[model samples]
Target: MVTGGFVVDLNKPLVSQVGHLGEAYEEWVHRPIVTKESPRFFASDVLEFLTLTVWWAVPLIWLPVVCWFVSTAVQMGFPSRQVAVTMVCGIFVWTLLEYSLHRFLFHIKTKTYWGNTMHYLLHGCHHKHPMDGLRLVFPPAATLILLMAFWSLVKLLTPPSVARAFVGGGLLGYIMYDCTHYYLHHGKPTKGISSNLKRSHMNHHFRIQDKGFGITSSFWDKVFGTLPPTNPAEKSR
Candidate 1:
């Protein structure tokens, strides 16, 4: 009964209240959307897929480039292992953010003033649109501001090389998170880890809806006690 493109809960039976779109729209926001066999991504929907691709890839790759520049500056013409280590560390840091942010920010039902506003602006907007195409990834302006803040923190506490490396790693984690999220929601895999992730994410969208917030991994869900129950409210989608 969805109309004007809205997210629907698949776990629940279709009711008149749920308008426009169906469960699939909300569940797989990043995929080439189609309820009844739209064109394949490369063939018919190439333009849409390409836009989403560049949306996530640019920032993910840009972090490393920025890091390289910062690292060189911080090195002061010196070669050391710190730069390498920072790069490695930086990437891992992103994974943490992926797990944490997805769990805490995206899934939570904000109850407070600021929390609710932030939720709506950030994750809620996605839930609402889910397929606007341009809104899938974080805005570049927002990304730049975040990076600037991180860079300032790095400069204050760590060497430029180390900071850049750490930031680079974080960017990778974000890239993985964004790309993997998009794939899980849309691009179906033949099988393997990607498939597994897809299933987990699907469950999050269609089955539980309120739990299994972790996208890349469920490590934090368990830690934070947000993991879905074995027998979740079945009418969840």
Candidate 2:
């Protein structure tokens, strides 16, 4: 049965999807199970990935890596094992980044002007308008600005060459996080590693937003004492 992916599709343009393979449509064509017409935006002949999803990703797909390479060259540091480590860690680092951003940046309930403004801009917009696909991921220009800021910080803390690796890794983490987050909210969860990761991430949307803030892993939550409570009952299978 069709399970997840763009649950309650909202503001989604015409999408070309087979409504639940066969069973769902058979019910629609015959039985017409109307438990109350949901606001869910499915049932269309046009393609969703092409129409609604793919266009939202164009800026992310080509924008960051282009900047990463050009910036790396300009920084005068030859890529090395440190760079490789950064790439590996960069992917893992996104979990921490995600956790921190969600817990601190997004979840800020401060009454102060700056803090409340930041919370609204960074995450409140997404929470209120989750289906604005283009707005879901960090835009290219904003991402570049962040990359510059992070690179500056890394450079101040290390040598040029080392900083290159460190910053590159961190940037890599951001790219992965943005992409995965977008895909999690947009694409269908498959049946492998991607599926597992997608489900784990999507749980944040359903169960508890305040907890389980890691996108790539629970590593950060474990580190910071924010991991969700144990649920052995669901895993008993």
Clashes of each: 12, 3
**TM-score winner:** 1
User: lDDT score, residue 30, model 1?
Assistant: 31
Task: Give the C-alpha lDDT of model 2.
Answer: 0.54
Q: How well does model 1 score by local distance difference test?
A: 0.56
- Give me candidate 2's TM-score against the actual structure: 0.62
Per-residue lDDT tens digits of candidate 2, residues 11-51?
34212222322323222222122222122223553422222
Using all chains and alpha carbons, the TM-scores for the candidates as numbered come to 0.63, 0.62
lDDT of each: 0.56, 0.54
Q: In candidate 2, what residue range of length 10 has the lowest lDDT sum?
A: 25-34
163-210: candidate 1 lDDT, tens digit per residue: 666676666566566666666656769798777667766666545666
Model 2 CA deviation exceeding 4 Å by range: 1-79, 111-117, 229-237
